[model samples]
Target chain A: MIEFRHVSKIYGKVKALDDVTFTVGAGSVTGFLGPNGAGKSTALRILVGLARPSSGSATVLGLPYAETACPGLRVGTLLDAGAQHPGRTGREVLTLGAMTLGLPRTRVGEVLDLVGLTERESRRTFGGYSLGMRQRLGIAHALLGAPEVLVLDEPANGLDPQGIRWMRRLLRDLAEAGCAVLLSSHLLHEVEQVADHIVMIGRGRVLAQGTADELSRGRGLEETFLELTAHTDRSPGATASPGAGAGRGSA
Target chain B: MTRAGHHLNDIAGAAPSPITKDEKMNADTPIPFRRLLAVEARKLVDTRSGKIIAVVMVALVVASVVARGAVVGPKLQTLVGTAGIALGTLLPVLGILTVTGEWAHRTALTTFVLEPRRHRVLAAKCLPPLLAAVALSLFAIVVAVPATAVVSEVRNMAANWEVQPLGLLGWTGGNVLVAAAGLALGALLLNAPAAIVINFSTPVLWAVVGRLGSAGAALAEWLDLNTTATPLMRGDMTWSEGARLAASVVFWIVIPMAAGLVRVLREEVT
Candidate 1:
């Protein structure tokens, strides 16, 4: 279970997230849809305690993630698949995660297999792995703990069609097994195919959230998504709120 | 049913899962300090930079000791002191990499996610290099013991086996302090190249400053760890020397480390 209540993040007058609120229940998949700079990553970072919220709170399993002892054991996160040390082999990355979580080293092989990485691929350093391989390694790391909650950002990036399909099934299986899954992605079709509930955000505001059919209505998912976010300013210098430049000096 | 049990009946097949009945029971338990230490220790030599620097440390220590034995004819104190000086100079670089590697390599996200009480993680990061200082000192002494004997016999010189315990302690302590200074700088800057540059260049800068006559020499005495550490390496110190050493330690190690710790604890990892 993950909850974001009125979470707002300001980075030197850039309101990355503004009064954002959402809840992800166990045994379900929530697709966090947003354009670039829509604050999806910031919100997810705040959820996992990587970034602090300027106002409001983000909690996982009834408490802030940092307060939860051994959080990696309970919540699997893949904020950046490429964030692993480049020199470490894929297996070594998983092994380190296993070691950190007090899991048996044998689990490394299992997750590698589950993510479709071969033995040779696993032994290669992460730097040499393709972007697809990096995504697989990151997925293996996230699944290393068999977490009760999963937070993945753009997990489908660099994945092939088959790999995307595999991820869809894996996520569905995890949610069916009672894991709460929060996935953020730019792929509308992938999100529609897998996510049970969709939370569409534009310009740091949640525009709409419901089941695919509920939100799509007469229009298709892509068209509905476009309509909802059509007016959002995607400019690099755009501000999220009025009077945003007022506190620029202090920010 | 256990998550692993669920996995057995799922599409993923009857593979071994990360969680089991036993693990689930202890899932919420805090990671023990020893586990963190073990992982941190492994991380020290696991990267290209960490491994290269570590290998360089060993080679330099051995080379310095053996070269000293050749030039000075196997005096235990001198050879061991050579090893100490070599380690003292290089270990700080190793320490800097160990702390900054998390940020440089972007593994801080993974590390902090796993262990969120960042102070504990920082403490764990600091210990492995210091421990290496102790372990490698023993290693240097191990090499020195045989080098002293072999060189003494080859050159037909009486071996001076006598070593001052205070000097050895001072040597080891000095290595630890300098290494801590490196760790502190790494934490303060959180950039490998930048921190390593500052670590090496600061002493040279201080050397230049110390050459500016009595005022400069006095400032170096009170503030430069390199200058204060000389008496420490030689096992010769008065109460005044000890006080001066304390002052330099505060100036070099404590203040930067405290500021670095605060920054690290409060800084966002993005």
Candidate 2:
């Protein structure tokens, strides 16, 4: 299980997340919805222990991630598709992940096959892959440890229809097998199709949370999402919260 | 597997094979520190840039030896010292890359996410290049062997087979020390270009600035790394000289490394 209990992340004077609390229970999928600067990425990064929430704890399986023993065994994260070194082969990337997770080396090929990357593609350097391929490799790394919780950010952003379908099945299967899966996405339709629960946030605060049917209220998810986020930020296009792009690089 | 869907009616639709117990979580063990070291070592030669650095390091060491052998007639001390200078400069670059490469390539997120304890990760990052530097030190001496022989045969130079173990240890130790300093610099800076720039420029800049007057000389005596390290090559420092060397290393390497560890632990990875 994954949880954020009264979490707030502040960068300088700006609050990226404000007292946000949510739970992603095992055997289910939770879709996190937010605007560009709404702190979806910030939340995911905190849950995975890449970024510490300034005022609260993000816990996995009841322990704060940093304090958890063998965190990789309980949590898998794909926060950045471009985070793998471009010069390393796809297999090497997964191998390093496997090594860190204390999994058997053979798990490398298993993940590559699970993600539908051919042998050649797996052997090729990551720099040669397209964005879609990188996303797939990122997913493969996330699955390397067979973690109990999967935290992914925009995982299907660059996938083809077939790849997306495969991802849907994989996520559903994992959740069915009692894994907790939380995803943050800009693809509203895909989130609608795959998420068992939905949490919508605006300006670092949760605006609404429930199932898609609950948030819909007879209007489609896209329309409702637009209406909810339309006036959330007063400045209209203020996407640069201090920590907005920090998930990719450090100061 | 009895799959769950959004609708209650879909729960009993069909079944597939379950994910086996072995495929479930392996939560009993965290990756060992030695394993982390091994993985970091593997990374040093895994990428194109790492390969280039390794190759370039070796080539430079050999070229330095060849230049000494061809010009100064391959005296063992001169040859080893030349290799030490060349390898000393390049090995630190490798060490810096070992830490900064993670941030430069944006791979720090994946790495830290997998192993969240930042200290263990940093410790692991320090091992590989230092180990390689030791190996490279031995390689340079070995290569100097053949060069010394060739020089004795052609240039009528006496082959100084009398080797001082303490001096050899000092040279190897000195090289490893510089590389660790590079690693600390990398961890402190986190940015590759910035870390590298500071790593190369700090000594040269201090060397120039440390020669202006008595005050500058005193500062250099206690704070200049290049001078403090000379006693290490000779392995014959007095207690006062040793204290001075310790002070310089603390100011340069230890402080940056401790600060960098904190920054790596606290800095947000986006």
Candidate 3:
């Protein structure tokens, strides 16, 4: 499981995250929704120990992510698909990750097939891959460890309709297999279709969080999300009150 | 509880329970150091840039021996001198690439993510370049042996079989030192082009300054890496000369590398 408690991140004078808090648990798919510049990436980066939080805590399995020892075996993260060495073949990239996790090389081929990357696709260097191919490779990288927790930010950005459909099923299956899955996306429909739980943040504050039925209120997911986050797009700092997210985070 | 109130319980409640001692111990086992070194080595030979630099280094070693053999009618050690310069100058660039490539290509995210302890990663990067320097030195000997015999055969000159084992070893050591200096500069300035420009230019610019006067010569004696390394490479240095060599290496190699390590360790991955 992953948890962020009253977390805040300040870059110079800018408060990227403002007293934000949430948790992701086993057997659940949580959609992390926020507008651009709303600290979604910062929060995810902190959760994975890629960035440090100015105050409060981000932990995996009850310890700091950096201190978790075998982190790859406990949690998997995909912050960006373009962060890999472009000259390395897709197969070599997965092999590196698998080796880091101490898994056998055969697992590399299995993950390649699972992500729908054909033998031919895996042979090419990442520089030649289209955005869709990069996304698949990134997914394959995340799944290489088969950890109980998964964190992915904007993972479906460049995928086709068919690819997106495949991803939705894959994530759902992983969650059903008792993994905690947290993903952030601009695709509300995709989130609505797959998310068992939803956590919405606006201007670095938790606007709302709950089960789909509870958040929808019989009205629908899109209307509730836009209505809550509309004020944030206008001015991020105006809503960054100290106690702003307390009620939502508590829930 | 109200729906919002109950949901807050999930947030507060999901804080991971305390891990057992066994679990903590399990988590403590980091990836082995040997594996990290192996990965760093593979990265050196796996890319187009790495491969190109390697080919250029090999060609430089061979070309120098051939030129000296034909023109100077060289002995073994004389042939070794030309090979040393060619290898010494170029291998440092390869060493620089090993550290700065991850930063330039933004592959640090993947590398650091897999091995969060930055020091281990840096040490791993230093490993392959040092080995390359040693291997290049050996290749120089391989090329020189044949070139020496060919020069003697073609020109009807005596093949000077006289060899100084220590001088040859010292020359190889000089190349290894320069390779390390390159890595230090690369780590200190985590950009490939910037590190490359600075690493190559420092010695040349210092040489020009060293020609000015007595004060300039004094400064060069203590700090100019190329000048200090020359006598050391020939294995003809006195005790005082060895001290000067040590002093130069301290400034060029040790200090920059120490600072570079501190910066790399503290840098945020984002």
Candidate 4:
């Protein structure tokens, strides 16, 4: 289980997460939804112990994420697919991660096979990998220790239809086996299909949180999302009146 | 029926009793820090750059022995020391490469993710290079010995091989310190070229500054680079000179290393 308690983050004068609080329960997939410039990535970074909150704290399995015993064993995270060594082969990269976690060496090959990259494991360098391939490798790396909690940010960014289906199934399977899965994506339909719970944010604040059905209500998921965030202008000086611009020009 | 019953009884007696649930739950397994270090060391050794550095050091050692034996006329010991100086130049370069490789390749994230304890990762990175420097220096001596002997035989000159064991030990220690200092500088600068240049040029810069006047010369002497410190390791320095050499090592190597460690801990890994 992952818990965020009254977490707040600031980047200079701008607030990245404003007094946010939420829980990701075990045996379920929670989709983190936010429009561009929202606190989705910041929140995820804090959860994984990469970025600290300006106030409050984040915990994984009741212990602070940074202070947990064997954090790699408890939580697996993929913040970005491109955040890896370009020179290392897929197998080498996974092996390094496994070694650090005190896992068996054979786990490296197992993860490669699990992610369907066994064939290209030795031949593919991270720098040369396709976006889809890198995504798969990232997921494989995150699963290295069979972690109980998995956190992924923008996991399906470059995936095709087939890869997307594979990712959805993998995430569901992980959750079904009693792992807490927190995934962030901009695609509403994808989240609607795969997420059991949703946390929606706009302008660095949680606007809504519940099951997809509850959040969407009677409207289409996309329409409901639009309705929730439509009035929340991301820009600081955005105006609601269309005729205001014309009136100002005439003046 | 009796025989079958006896056989069944024997089989049941042979089977071991199962462990109690409480005992199984209470069993404790300790984390293996030593094993983790070994694994990290193995990973570093298995890399392409690691192998290249090892091979190049060996080759340089051999070449140095041969060139010195053939041309320097039985001043084999001095020649080996000269070779040590040349090999010393590569030590800092290797250190720079090791640290910068993490950032250049984006592996620092993977490394930090697994260990999470940044200090342990830094320690692991430093250990291999220090060990390698010592091993390479000793190997250089071994190579120098045989080559000197052969050259002595071929040239028909009396080979005065002054094997100063303490001096050799001191030189090896100095080399290890130099490598560690390099690694620390690499961490501080976090750039290969900049760190290497700064470390390589410090002694020279001190020497140039020292040559300006009496005060400058005294300061330069005090700021001995590995080059000036080389004579001390050979036991050729006076008491005052030896103290000055030790001070130089501390200033040039120790201080920079501490600063680098601070930077590494505080700075964001880019």
Candidate 5:
């Protein structure tokens, strides 16, 4: 379980996360939803101990994330797909992460296979990897220790339809095994399909939180998402189109 | 209630909780520093760049020994001197490559995520190169031994090329210091090309300044990296000169290293 207790972050004069508070329960997939620059990434970083909150605290499994004895083993994260050494092969990158957690080196190959990158693991350099491939590799690295909690920021970014499907399934499996899976995405429909719970933020403040069906009411998930996060200054007038709404609900 | 039910209830109330001492021990045991360092070292060694740099250093040392022993006779000292110059130029470049490799590959995030204590990660990164520098220096001396003997036999002249163990140690120490300084600079710059350029150019610029006049020479002798490193490497300095050399290294290497470490710990990995 991950808990944010009055956590706040500021950059210069702008408040990146404004006294945010939430809980991600175990055995469930929690989707963090917000428009760009809405503190989604900042909140995720704080949860993973990459960034300290300006005020208050974040905890993973009742202990401070920063104070966790084995952060790599306890909480796996993929904050950004691009955050890897481009010169290293996929296998090498995963192995490095595994070693940090005192995990067996063989787990590197296992993750590669899990992410469906086993064939290209040795041959693909990070610099040459396509965006989708990089995302998959990043996910593989995050899964290195079989961490109890998984924190992913835009894990589906750069993935195609097939890759996205794989990702949804992967996240579900992880949550089913009692891992607290917290992922951020701009795609509400994807969240609606996969998330057991939803935490919505706008302009660095929570606007809504509940299950997908509970949050959307009887309206289409995307339409309801757009309506709930409709404040112009926060979202910049980007709303789900009718066709997108239909396609998403069917999917 | 039956006698058995009464006994079970009494047992349930009287029995201590099942929290074992082992569970408490597991919770209290923090991850060891050595384990984290070993993990960092493993990452450093596993990379292609790390392997290439090691291979290149060995190749350069062997080639220097063979070429000087086989081709150049009386100028063996000069060849050694040339090799020293080449190493001074190259070691810093390798150091920059080592430090910036994390950033260039976007692996800094992964590295720091694994070891959230950034300072520990930085220290681990420095350890491998420093050890390798000392080890390579010893290896170079050993290789030079056989090559020097072979040259003496071929030329029929007394092998006056004595290996100064202290000189080797000082030179190796100086190289490690410079390499660390380069690593720090790379961390601060966070770009491989820029860090390498600054590392190599700083000494060259000081040399140019030294050529201006007596005053410039004096200033250079006091402030210049080459002047400081030369005395330490060659064992040709008085006590006062050695102190000055030590001071110069501290100023150049220690200050930059501290600054780089600060930057690494404070700056967000983008």
Candidate 6:
């Protein structure tokens, strides 16, 4: 249960997000797809209360995410897998999160196990972990509190093939169990394979959104995505133009 | 499915873990302040930089006391006062590190994500260093007691154990004020190198300004914490001296800390 209502974020001359709106219902996986600088990360940041929106609002479970009691337990998020302190052991990082959320210490062990990090690996400092290990640790941290909703950004960035498949199954399983999952990624094909619904964005505007089959038609999701985003110029100062919000990549 | 996926499938495919589902349905309670304090306090000594600073604090205290014993025969007041040198000078650096470390390490995102109330987080961050100042002041006294006995016995001098409780309180209070100044500056800047440099450099600047004339010297009495704090550490104060100390504390600790709190609360953690 996540909703973005007419949300717009402007930083100086750049409109990072413009009248963007979307939703991910309970027991569903909504893949938020966009190119670089497409405002995906900016929108997620606003949703999690890291960055304030210039207009409108975003809410989770009927309340702004920051206002919800024990938000860490109600809504889990992994905006940047590398946001952890490098000097801390993976276990220590998770333990602190557990402490912050008032969760049992065993939850740390369970999530560490769920994310496929071994006890030995968990004991090692985060600075020494590989990028894939960081992603796992981040995922473990997101799941540590048993949240009802997950807002993840590029969760599969450093994962191997196996790790990717495991993540797909985990998201699917979480959705099956009635967790709302909003996943953002650049991997169009992976989004096609796992996402129950798709929202395509380009240049801070929603380009298209529907079930995979409906949006892809017969041409497949990748070609449709490229065709939709290709007409929008991806540059820093392009947001000020009158025609920047052209619908569906109209040239 | 990959090998890891197969292993996790048993847990994943079997629907949500019972614990997770149960907890999700359980009552929504806010994070307790005690837990936040414990977490913030643990973060202080958890890093390599944090450990290095701590070890340096201990070493400086020991070195100062032993050197005092060698040079001045370890009088009780001097021994205790000398041992506080490390705490007064460097404990604030520790305070600076605790605040700036969150920004330097990029853990602010994670911290804010878990607990979005920035003011609550700031409040939690502020208390640990003040507590450390009190603890370390006592620790310095603890280390000085043994050093006084051992050093006096080695050099064939009697150890003086007579020091006023008021004097000890003054010493600890001054150290706490200095540490609070450090915390305030760190929060104001949110950068370790910048805050630490500014924290150390302001006193030197004040020393130079104090040499300008009677006006500069008078200004320093109200602005330079080092000058105003002397009477405080000596356990003697007139009403005028107390007022001056209060003025300097406001200039050094209160103003910066209040401004820093506003900045921290309004800051966007991107």
Best by DockQ: 1
The regions of model 4 sitting more than 4 angstroms off are A227-251, B1-31, B212-218, B236-239
All candidates' TM-scores? 0.94, 0.92, 0.89, 0.86, 0.86, 0.93
**DockQ of all predictions against the true structure, Cα-based:** 0.48, 0.44, 0.24, 0.15, 0.25, 0.47
What lDDT would each prediction earn against the true structure?
Answer: 0.85, 0.81, 0.80, 0.73, 0.73, 0.84
Question: Cα deviation of A45 in candidate 6 (Å)?
Answer: 1.0
Q: Residue by residue across A1-251, what tens digits does model 2's lDDT show? A: 88899999999999989999999999999988766678899988888888888898889999888777677767888998987788899999988877776667777777777787899999899989998999999988887666778999989888999988978877887787788999997567778889999998888998889999989989767666766666664453533432332222111
Q: Check candidate 1 and list the clashing pairs.
A: none
User: Which runs in model 5 stand beyond 4 Å of their true positions?
Assistant: A119-123, A232-251, B1-31, B74-81, B154-158, B208-218
Q: Write the per-residue lDDT of candidate 4 for residues B45-67, one digit (tens) a residue.
A: 55666678768877887787788
Q: TM-score: which candidate is best?
A: 1
Candidate 1 on B29-125: residue-level lDDT in tens? Answer: 9998888888998887776766887888899889999999999997998899899878878888888888898898799998998888888989999
Which is better, 1 or 5, measured by TM-score? 1
Task: Point out where model 3 deviates above 4 Å.
Answer: A234-251, B1-28, B211-215
CAPRI verdict (incorrect, acceptable, medium, high) for model 3: acceptable
Tell me the tens digit of each residue's lDDT in model 6 across A1-251. 89999999898999888899899999899999887778999999999999889998999999998888789888889998888788889999999988888767877888887889999999999999998999999988888777779999989889999999989988987777678999998678778778999999877999899999999889877667877776665754544342442332322
Over A1-251, each residue of candidate 5 has an lDDT whose tens digit, in order, gives 99989998889998988888899999899999876667899898888777878998999999887687667766788999987666677777776666666555666666777677856555677778989998988888877666678999999889999999988877776676567999998777778788999998867888788998888788756766666555523422344344433332223
In model 6, which runs have C-alpha deviations exceeding 4 angstroms?
Answer: A235-251, B1-27
Candidate No. with top lDDT: 1
Docking class of 5: acceptable
When just chain B is superposed on the true chain B, each candidate scores a TM-score of 0.92, 0.89, 0.87, 0.80, 0.81, 0.91
lDDT of 1 by residue, A42-133 (tens): 99989999889999999999999999988987899998999988888888888888898888888888888888899999988899988899
lDDT of 4 at B241: 72
The deviation in Å at residue B80 for candidate 4 is 2.4
Q: Compute the interface RMSD for each candidate structure.
A: 3.0, 5.3, 8.5, 11.7, 11.3, 3.8
lDDT of 6 by residue, B1-270 (tens): 355345444654222454555655432777778888999998888777678887888888888988887888857789879877778789778889888888988899999999998888888988998998898888888888888888789999888888988888999999999999999999899999999999889888998889989999899878898889888888997899999999999988899989988988888886
